[model samples]
Target: MCSCILLAALKNADEMLKDIISAVDTSGDGKIQYEEFRVFVEAAERQLLQLFRSIDRDKDGRLNKEELQAAFRRAGLSVPKRRLSGFFDEIDLNHDGFITFDEWRDFLLFMPTNHNGSPLEAAFSFYSSIVTVNPEGDSLVSDETLEGLGYFLAGAVSGGVSRTATAPLDRLKVYLLVNTKTSSNVAIAAAKQGRPLVALRNAGGPIVDAIVSLWKAGGLRTFFAGKLLLGWSRVLSGTDSHAGNGLNVVKIMPESAIRFGSYEASKRFLAAYEGHNDPTQISTVSKFIAGGIGGMTAQFCVYPIDTLKFRLQCETVKGGPQGNALLLRTARKMWADGGLRAAYRGLGLGLVGMFPYSAIDIGTFELLKKSYTRAVARYYGIHEDDAQLSNVATAVLGATSGALGATIVYPLNVLRTRLQTQGTAMHPPTYTGIVDVATRTVRNEGVRGLYKGLTPNLLKVAPALSITWVCYENMKSLLKL
Candidate 1:
């Protein structure tokens, strides 16, 4: 009798809750889309869940401190100080030390905790909410698209690094792009163990075979065969690029009295004021964003040059320039060998590569520069954000940090290149389709087969990334982008 009574009450409560949710769902489409769902309910649920294990307080969508504290209070449980502080910090969810309704909403939807549980489950649940055009549910993205995106990011990083670092990076990428499986990380690991010789690559292969081996063996931090030369080149490139852009930007301005940073400040101030936002610190952010834009443009616009370079480099290992005779001869040979389309074989990979690589590299550099600037300012008790020297210093710091990000994310480049440029060389009896090429490579070579040439790529990454960031940062500072 007692069990039956409890079951009846639970059923009633569930029906009532469903009725309320359905009422708010309003569209009566029988499914609550993530964007269309009641915003408050989502927020409330997340907060309540994060707060306590049992009760669904506020019933918004998430668990918050309020919901947690309330549940504890109702249960007469004591809350520890340490737990309370963390809850306070996250209550706003915006990293802004204050809780807003929108932040609350995001917490409900995005917080790792929450219903259906598991981030993967939540993601699929949200995905089901997106409006799709497929009437019969046949339209879907394939693994190929995801793989393509990965390769694209990789290509972007590799290509971007090339523009930033120049010739040595060219040599480095060839080594790294060999085949991803050769991670005899005796090089990277050997550094901490005091045996540098273990990291060296073998000789008698290509133009820069020995250098390529050390790069693969050592990875990024220790892979600097021409470390000093790379650094000097980076500095020179940055200085020249920045100085040139800066001079140009100033030349067009009302510059009888205007100066470098001053012109930049004027443009930023106008935009912020026009948009009715704070402009003081924003001037610093503009250049970083602009540099990112520039990186993407340069990468895509002259990417054919990059494609040509990669093909040239690969053929060098296979036969050397003697096979094509010279740059002009090689260009003619490549076109003749594969026709027009073969010359642009890896474009999709390049496109995908640019977005993530540039975004990560530029974003990280900006963040680091801001951190360093603040640290230095606080150390010196200097509070002026618009100070000329401080801004320039921040730019430099950002450039260096951006380079490191590029290095870390460099392997994707090797993967994309292998996937795009390898296989059916546009000749007869070769499966020329991207999907067909990828499938054959995996089938015959195994999964590791796809990751060829990753080591030398990793080694080249450090300097290549370093130079890329420096050039970007310096250009932004100069161009006031």
Candidate 2:
């Protein structure tokens, strides 16, 4: 008889709660808005206050570090005192050494807690009230403005991180490119010995030579030489190229932005043309075409910087002018010879290489991501969107794509660098144009010379690109995109 009476009372309480919810739902969409939900939170504050008072051993209305620590301990957490101090620092928004009633209320209802409990469940419920996209939904705010922030931010962050991580390898590549002493000796040794492959293998490869050179120069620190200055210079210079020529001018940011923007825009356009609402439905070939177009656009705008940067890095490596003097001299020389055109000496070759490189890199990454997403979705019987891969998976796929693309497009990189650095004082201008550079490279050092520093190139490209893509995806996820 007592159990039947309790069940009847529970049913009545549920119906009353439903009545209150419906009454507060002004939009009549069967969902309560954030403002209405606040009313519910305010009503529950009385119950929360009792618990707060219990933790206040000194009968004070505020929570100090000690009180907060006690609360965590009561919840079965064994956080260190230092960590507890950090937590107090966070909760004490005004930093007045105490968590006030308002702050405590906010923390309990809004701040994320690692522990799972009734309070955390309530906080999550409150969080869900603000992230709606429609007026009919139960939300206080719209997330429409944040829609594209993720993708753009992801690309930018990834590009920056990748470039920074691969600075050492890139420095090595530049060093090898300008100083071909080790490679020249290797080639000579191969020629002297009838067995070219055996002789080449016997002589230390570019990696060993680079390592020895870097150590002689200044140990591991030498790899980071000019890193800080070039890094900033690349940012100041546009994305595709650099205002500072000596830093490889291949600034990753502009290329990433333009490349991602163009690819997305092109994909959208094609999808619209095909009457497909879903952008991902666009075919791989269409994506390739879009990537090609995007890559060409970005590289063309930045090619002049590309030329200047190559000259700058090469000159610096060879111990030419040190700072501003170098920049002024290079500018003056280029101007004296051909003005603006001189600054864009090897654009034709750059365009040729960039198109294929960008297209292959972007297209391959997208395809791989889709494949991974699909596989995960199949395994779990979920929608493709819901099966997004983990951060590690995304980063690995990005690195793989970058490595593959860099290998295929490496010869062009070699030729472009050689042509850009040829006219300097140490290496007299040998090539009049792209054809001349290519022909002379083959004639002078065989096909191998065209790929002088490929080992470092591959090492840098793979990780740099991987970091870029991985960072991008991670940022997007953080933004809830």
Candidate lDDT values, in order: 0.43, 0.64
**On residues 1-481, what C-alpha lDDT tens digit does candidate 2 reach at each position?**
2212322334233443455556566578888899876775665466557667876878778878767666655544433343355456645779999978777676444222222554523333333332232234333333322344445555656666677678788878877765534235665577687877877775656678677866565455456543433544543444312224234325556656666666666776787787753466788988877788778877776666656665655444333444556655766765776788777777778778887888888889999989999999999997565687787887788888878877888889888777766766534555788888888777777788777777888888877877887777677556645
Clashes of 2: 7
Best by lDDT: 2
Best by TM-score: 2
TM for every model, in the order presented, reads 0.41, 0.62
Deviation from truth (RMSD, Å), model 1: 20.3
lDDT of 1: 0.43
- lDDT per residue for candidate 1 within 1-481, as digits (tens), equals 2212322334233443454456456577787677655474555466534543453455554445555445544543333333343444543545654444454344334323334543323422232322121333344453223323333333333333434344444445554444333334445566667775654542213325545544444334223222223233432344321111121121212111122222233434454665633332444445444334444554555455545544444333322222224334546665775766666665665545554555456555656666666676787786424223443564355446545545544444544455334532211123455566567656755665554444444445545455444443344343222
